[model samples]
Target chain A: MATYTRKNAWNQNGTFSNSDLLWYAKGVRAMQARALNDQASWWFFAAIHNEYLSGQTTFPGWAYISAPPAVPTSPLPSQSIRDKFWNQCQHQSWYFEPWHRGYLIAIEAQIRAIVIGLGGPNDWSLPYWNYFGPGNQYKIPPAFTQLTLPDGSPNPLFVKARYGPRNNGDIYIPLPPVSQDCQRNTIYTGSNAVTPNPGYGGPSTGFSNAGSVSGNLENNPHNMVHTYIGGSITSTDYGLMSDPGTAALDPIFYLHHCNIDRMWASWNAAGNANPTSTNWLKGPAATGGRKFVMPMPSSRAGWVYTPNDMKSLSQLNYVYDNLSTGITKQLVGSLAQRLTKLGVNLIQTQPQPDENMDMGGNSEMVGANEGALTLKNSGARTAVRFQKEAWAKVPKSLMNASVTKVPDHVYLQLENVKGKMDSNVLAVSVNHKLAGHVSLFGLRKASSNDGHHGGAGLTFILDITNLVDELHLNNALDADSLDVTISPDNDIPNDEEITVGRVSLHRQPQS
Target chain B: MTAAERSRRSVSLLIFVLSATCWGLLLVKPAAVKHCFVTGGELSRTSLEILLLTNPISPMLAGWGLMVLAMMLPKLIIPIQYTCERSFKNRRFRAASLFVLGYMGVWMVVGALMIGGILGLTLFMPGSYTPAIVVGIIAAIWQFSPVKQQCLNRGHNHKALAAFGRAADYDSVLFGFEHAVWCVGSNWVLMLFPVLLPGGNNFVMLAVTLLMLSEHMEAPRTPRWRINLSSKLIRILFAQTSIRLARS
Candidate 1:
């Protein structure tokens, strides 16, 4: 098989054209016309990612399959395919990157076949929406926004329900929320053991849907994109892009995920390693075991895969057109601007170690709030009292930047965040300095602890080393308690809908 | 500490007290504790009046409820912690109390039915371990079954609770009941096995309790026929030991 290069959707390097998107739109339209029960239908492929509310008769703005035929539904998919492949999207797990890679390949193969049938080029690959690319790329591609094709036919890529931030059917994704800070993470896998480490991908687990905590990459740009493009948090019916179950139903979702896959490739190119563990390579196993399975577009059995099978894009017969324009470049530029505003001497300062280090050792919970705080439309605040005894347990050089190369990292953890809906993004700050934003994009699924992380709910650990450094510089580090504020970026009608079980702080010393 | 933390601590204390008291009673008065174990042979052999005079319903129910509090309350920390955390700080205790009441209420009803079933089985086949062994085998088979795994998976489910008034109370109780329903569905056979044994004493109960706790700790997987011996407790213990050793 010949390798194909997946280019940027916005025609960043001027290599891509309108015809690529036109052919993609045509393929999508052809797939949409198939029966809901058909294995190769657009609904079938989307359902494979997730179909949370499958029993519901209506899906608001989009077509829904109320009751997909039972196993042995279609001969093409077969009973085995229906049993294992549907609703198998790996979210909140280490397998997330690999699982989605296989999903995109399977869907792309189906679409490519359909495109070929419609007399399109054989080498056509899925174009990625690189919102972090260059000038004016943050906005939704014009092709997706267009109501009709050049031939004056209805555009399959265009959906009328997109209720992005403006709530005016425009998707202008803000650059700040979708930071590529995840590229700085050195470790491939993180542990939620006694000492929690937020890995670049996610924590190690055996087949997780909503694991304890999201890997830094999944938490940010990936989730941020999902929320903003979906709609405003306050909207009655957020678009198909809001929730994972309906996200793939939207045409832009594939391109969004294609860019996310490119991030993984870019991360690897920077010399970061993927996990070499047997558990990760072989997939989650116990008695019956679990494997990544997807229905092939042709007359063949379902394609069974492991993380090992998806470890290489070259092996999969595809490569990204460009890997140089990942989020790290934007992050560095933004950091320099922030530091300049703070009057830091850029020439004299030494290059600091990666702040987002996944230190695997004994991390202590140094402070916590007295009770859970229900985040509101206006905002919520709490005082996390530092345990006096905990300070003595760690190295005295904790958060002391001048004395150590690998100083202890102070992390703010929002534990067990439960919510009824998605598309809410909360700006979290420590002592009034903006630390990070918690994107509750898949709050519903992540909160449903039934099948995943044992009701741990969604835990977010934001690195606040720099914030702590500032606090130390001002002699504010010795205070008995730190004021933590959670303010929603968008208005949330129901205060009862979202609640953080606890606001705690931990200090992880470098190993 | 936070109200949620306080609530969890209190729950731990309650479990410890209940377990200690029950275990002490079992040690001091094994015969009296054994009387609480309902059996068909005694009911068929003795008159109703004699049975009432010897084995009273009040003590039996009390012993059974005490047993449940000791053996099962530990398994409910997640939902109880969640209930407390979700409620107003002042109402945390009330919310958790309601949840415990609702959980124990379901287990009480199920315990009565299980007692009745044990009586029937013992009546049909008296003075033999055959029935007990058969029930044990059935429980073992059910452990590997897909339906049982499905029930275990459902047991981890929790939902957003209302923060105020009767809605909060109702939601807490409803969550408790739902959790109990799934819990009983997954462990009914394992629970039934101990009751069927001739000397179904506290020792057997303790062993079964450990098994159930271990099973609950395992992450949910695809529902299929498979043996699940993954002990998260053991893993935690090992990890903690390593961390401590490395630190020292």
Candidate 2:
């Protein structure tokens, strides 16, 4: 998913966007429906899986082989068995929704490949799990119980297999198969539903990884919440994430990231798009770092995510399509032309148009004011500094007061930069969400191993005590928060050079 | 041949001649060049002239273009020589890996010394002398040491040279890996320069590169040295492994 708000951040929904996340969720859900509608689809496949594990099947040529050529319908369910299955499922929380959404996508893709054979509309497309990549910390959920169906009854294995030897060892508990069929009309405990993590996206949304957050929930972006809860997991294996020990192995890891991507998408939408508004996320910090900040994929302090060799979503061979779509309405009007005509001698005269037709730079934020823009430093980032050739306004008194409780502290309305210009600095203030936070990124000259001085310097991160201390908030300040735009330091070159960079808030206070 | 005679002749005849020949080809006379100022510090002509005079070898640092040294010299020449004696010398694990051991032993001491020199230069130097003089002294002094011989990959002082006129694949690989380790160790001093600077721009890159270069040393050695070989090369080809594992 793209950035949720104008600011590059995870949505409160805790989502990430990728074609895989969408396609996989849809695929998995579709597969689930396929499996449940005709139990033969899933159960038959599950049987083959069981046999393969138990050394029974000599040549299990296919994932499934439905008996009675015609798909079975109105299947008879054993009362006791169905009741037990329903009973077990009734207890589960829906927090697994977006999470399972990814696995189902992958599983569906796999099934499509196996049954339909690797191409066409049913072509298999799986999540690109960072199996051997960096930032590998996957925790397997306890939901996937490895149980065998003995004469159609769920039988328990590994009774003493690892029973008392590890983790208080209670041999066997009644194993319940992972099912999504009984969920209709089921009031899900929104608390645990795998929705967008508040840390990443806004409320009531699933794990979106919008890169912003508004709705408050525990590990809303459930996948990353694993890292938040469990210490960490390495890239273990694929399609085998199980137990807390083997989560990284699960093929679902990529899907989890995809959902997190979605949460981020939602967050992009959640941000206050108004050019003069402020969404109080948190205020300045008390040294160390920002009161709050999100972990960036490739940041120096947190897991920094940069555009990889094939990092752009466009480059990915796989693309995810959403089961649902958000409204992307386009405006049809000529307001600017009308405004020009309305200045009929009654208003002030407009300035002569500049010669350059391409006034916009690629890096410019789209909103009237940059909405919750997220800037980060990687590789031992310690501080953030900002400097510029122009004057930057401070936050209003009310907004400043809001910072007292850390309602919001983000930069806004940054001047666009283009080409390789000389040291044009922007203001910088490190948000305290991690260590080595930057308070300012003084002006910098970008040169390719030679003299090609350019705009905006990015200084090494250091402690962010000063910016937080000089708290400037702008509530009622409208969409464009005034205090956030780094004021150009007039004392220095004072010639078009500006620098702006800030460290994310220091690790969200342990919680 | 007497060891001293063989070593000296090898150094003078092969290494020196080859080195001079290679260096001779790369010498480019500096002409009109772009002047870049660091920190808006006035770059005076006097400063440039003085710096040029002092830093004679600095020009060769980048445009040295002697990449063949990294390959042909270290990789090919040593393999042909080390092979002849590997079998008899190995006579099967009787002696604990002389080539890799000796090569690595020299590598460690040299690496440490180089590292120490770098630390001293960066931490201790008062910036009293010109870079040319400093580098010249460094280059001159290095010429006499075992480190220079190994790093340059010349066969002089190469103990197994006569014995293994055409060494096997195993000996070559061991020597090659050892050479890689030493190469890293040898460059430690020079690599440290970029990292120690206190700024963010290019200085940070230099620091990171230094870190990566340093970490890269951890490869091809240590626990990897602990791998066991199959039956065939145990006694013959050397650290051919299983023998090392058995000893361990």
Candidate 3:
């Protein structure tokens, strides 16, 4: 009943509205303000949604809203220089830039329509919880949502996406495992006979090595939208008596998808601006985004989605309508808080929880490295012996891998190497491509030469995000996360095989 | 009358009035629609407004979009009172054209008011939905008002008009407003809900869609239902208004 009336109503310029619109209006603004804190992230989200919107209205997929990502083989740029790489990376060029652009613009329009349909913008700014950091680390303004729950309520989910009040109180709702039937829908199709990229990309022979990828997924030479993070929407409500995808049952999917679509669009926009640098397209999509199955020759030894394939945005019938800068803030604000927690703290100044950096800045749980980590003996000043074990927290850090987001993949680099030639600098790595599984995904290839004296200073890059991403559905997971192994060749003065001296993470500024 | 016939006439009149309004307003005077959308102003007589007047479809589509007013106008204004008044005179023949044109003109002008009102809402109101929806719903139900009935009916069959076109003018006026009222009653809720979609997902699009189709499906054959449905809507709207008023 709190709607405006003839005599006392408000216009955009005036303070009009029945009381509820004021509150409702506030929620919308808050959503926007929260997003604006980081415009780049939201732009990427918008691109993904836009691509889906466009494709959904056009080609229309069954069950899922978009058709799988397309993989084109005929367009290959063949050359003698490409032959150096292995065969598994044949069809890996689809998940690049301008393609992501189409998706970004389309979804922007969808959310805008929702905004206009609501009422319009009430002025608001994205707010960063002091719980994360004070400054640039958590400043994206536009990704905020209508305040879902009151602040300070303890979120009880495992692998916690929640951020605020020092982490204990806020966590995500523990997710149920994918139902037996749901897994059936994710049937993968990969090929072994055809080597994907003969020479252009990375190792084609060992793609599925040691649980690297879903064999069929990596082998599938198509499906671009599947990602390092999440899966694509498949069919819906199979239990319905009569199919109603056309009937528009559960229309709420559109709005939820608007968020998903927005994420993809934002990613696409970023991809457009920063196309992979060297050997970018020369390699296959590290993740099985564009194709159903990727060629994982290395992982054939243990576990891997050898032929990993992903879906394409064009297959989606819908696209995002490009929106004004003012509109994307709600989306940004929502994501910023989550990123603050998962991403490592990178503020260079005072290394503690400050308003300007991530919340965990100063905790002993996290350590810093000037570059190559330095190790000193417990009692000795000359730092002659490297310890068997060293550790620090790294929620934010560059994931090193032939392919990133391989769940729990951890790669250690030796920064601030201050020691004698024979003094050892040890590098360690852990790769857990799937959860609850052993570190079969972990690979340890030393830097070949550890120190100048060649006493054995090893440098290894590990990627285990895939394990984290998949197993994360289980509540038991925590910072107790590990797999990472040290090289057998490296000589740590002590009995422990691997020692991590320092850890650091990186993040962008909040413009 | 058959509901189908009424629907057909209703649709034709809606299209006719809309097309006529577009053709007429653009040819005669149409500064309202052009500048209204971009600058979000309709009544302003600025150079931007003048530019709009010169642009054809700018005002044409704008004018057409609002002729929804004319659909409900005929049912409320030209019907019961005006044409009956015209039927009694011998000069009713000449008066039919004048009256129909006048009646059509009145709705067209009203359309402009709405087009202008929408412009005003976007420009002046900024981001308020309550006012826009309230206005749309009110404009929708107001067609049933006795006063609106009198103005539309009387203007169509003034003493001079009544003296000119006898029975035909009587039918024309009666037929005219019936056209207008039906449209306003049917489209009001659907259009109004979009204004709410942004604020809350709870508005329930499916329920609202059904209500609108039900109203549109039975305009003449089930005048009772239309009246019943409209009365309920009118009451609900004002009931909402009163509560809001109390809160404010």
The best candidate in terms of TM-score: 1
Evaluation by DockQ, superior candidate among 1 and 3: 1
Report model 3's chain A TM-score: 0.22
TM-score of each: 0.73, 0.25, 0.18
lDDT tens digits by residue: candidate 2, A272-388: 110110111111111111112111212212221111211123333334443111323111112223223322221234342221111111111111221123322211122222211
Comparing 1 with 2 on DockQ, the higher-scoring candidate is 1
Candidate 3 chain B has its poorest 10 consecutive residues by lDDT at: B217-226
Q: lDDT per residue, candidate 3, B1-248, as tens digits? A: 11212333553465456544543443354456432222323433445355435434445445444433323333333232323222322333344444455445545555555555554454445445566467447745653444333332222211211112134355355445444443433354444443332234223433443344333322121011113242323333444465457659
User: Which runs of model 1 end up more than 4 angstroms from their true locations?
Assistant: A12-17, A57-82, A191-196, A207-210, A233-235, A286-289, A326-358, A391-395, A399-405, A449-456, A494-496, B1-125, B128-154, B157-185, B197-248
TM-score of chain B of 3: 0.35
Error of 1 at A133 (Å): 1.0
Please state the Cα-based DockQ of model 3 relative to the true two-chain complex: 0.00
Q: After superposition, how far is residue B200 of candidate 3 from its true place, in Å?
A: 17
Ranking by TM-score: 1, 2, 3
TM-score of candidate 2 versus the correct structure, residues matched by position: 0.25
For candidate 3, write residues A1-511 as lDDT tens digits. 3121111111221121223223333333333332211221221222212111111322122223211112111222222211121111221122222222222232233334334456754321111111111233122111121132234322111111112111232211111111011111111111111111111111221111111121211111111111101111112211110111111111111222233333333333432112232112222223211211211112211112211111333443333333111222222222223233345333344222112111111111111222122233331111111111212122222222111121122222222122211112122333323211111101111111111111122211222333333333443234433433333211234422233332321111111
lDDT of 3: 0.26
lDDT (Cα, tens digit) per residue for candidate 1, span A163-231: 786566789788897777776665666521111356778766532222456777888889888888877
Model 3 scores a TM of 0.18
